[model samples]
Target: MKKFYYTLLALFFMLPACTKTDIVPFTPETDNQLLEYKIVNVQGSPIYGAINQQDSSITVYLPFYLQLITLEPEMKVSDGATVTPVSGTMIEDLLDLFHKGREIKYNVKGKDGKVKTYTLHVQVQQPDLILQEVSTDADNPNTYSLNMNLDFDSFSFGLDGAGFAADLDMIRVMLVDEQNKEYGPLNISTFNTTDLTRLDFTVIRYKEQSDPILAMLPAEGLYRIRVYSYAKVATTKNPIRINLLNKK
Candidate 1:
């Protein structure tokens, strides 16, 4: 019995020592907190939105971006961070677009991370614009001037998104006849993609060199404007603007 008691006491003392073992210090990994990223346009199109700034810097188009992260405590970017607005852009215009997109994220660095960015959908809001047929020559209703109604001090994107350094080759304009036949590739003379609710698009009258006189077409016929924007592959939405005067 005495021998057993001594052994038990020795084991008890050992247990206490085992419980107080020293631990090694931990070190966090040092690397750019990035998993994967993507850039897209407002039409929910995938693209590598970028711009070559003549000056070492330029604002580029990023209709939207997403990040796939493995950790949560690790942040990527913050919300409402001052992003380099797309080059040739206005803060007010960008803000309006961001607001319309409803999902905006800041490109952050280090612990100031935003989150496991799901999908911050930015959109190219139709600039608040309206197209009107104002005739300088009252004698000829066919001769009219296309006027633009714009309300902005600063904005981004251009008419038809051209000259803004975007992929314009993918955009086009079309004109459909009464039989729905097409005739175009016409230059978008006056139109805008700025963030607006309404905009004056273009003025068209019978031009011998350009458009055939309305009287030449079927006196009793119909027509439509087809806008095939580059966004979808198998499916495309047609925003048809018609001749309100001719339509019954």
Candidate 2:
């Protein structure tokens, strides 16, 4: 009876070892897409590209002054995927490609050996205002003058580009003294309507009700004028040096 009980316990323990469990097979990843793209470390601001998965293309709008050849793109791809000309590579031939109206191309491959190509289209944004020239008024010692090219249609619509009447208030004029002391939200004298392309205007000395001396233009100091709209700005290319002891 003791031997029979020991044999039954051994058989119970061995039964579990003999049973089998299902094994899961490995599956290769098929995801191969460029998930995100951006141009970073540019002159002013970082630019993000709009990605269109359906068309497998990306579009980026850059400031007109930004050189395309200097672009180093950062990209993110799907897991288990690799992209050619890897991220953070400067696109040397970008300007030449743009001049020929050709798009920059990138290739991505997945672990399953499948590949997809994506094209990048770059465009330059049009300026709302262009500064042409700036100078000091010889006739009026305290007055500063400048010329600019205005996109009347763009200025009329405002910065958001969604309005009927012209938002003339969007344009501003300012004066900066040698010490970097800034003055004015000065008033523009008037516009020369004869040639809209060559819009001419003048800015007289700024006035303040509280401080008369501060209101008057300094008799002797280096100064410059700044003209700007929402989209662009123009300043004296060279500083205007002044040394008029008799003038107020």
* Top TM-score model: 2
Error of 1 at 101 (Å): 30
Local distance difference test, per candidate? 0.32, 0.58
Clash number for each model: 19, 0
User: Taking the tens digit of each residue's C-alpha lDDT, what string does model 2 give over 136-224?
Assistant: 35333342221112211111100112211123444555567766666665554345323334333333222222222223556555566
Model 2 Cα shift for residue 142 (angstroms): 43
- State every prediction's TM-score relative to the real structure: 0.23, 0.39
- lDDT (Cα, 0-100) at 179 in candidate 2: 68
Error (Å) of candidate 2 at residue 71 is 0.6
For candidate 2, the TM-score is 0.39
> Judged by lDDT against the true structure, how good is candidate 2?
0.58
- List the lowest-lDDT window of 10 residues for candidate 2: 151-160
In angstroms, give how far residue 86 of model 1 lies from its true place: 36
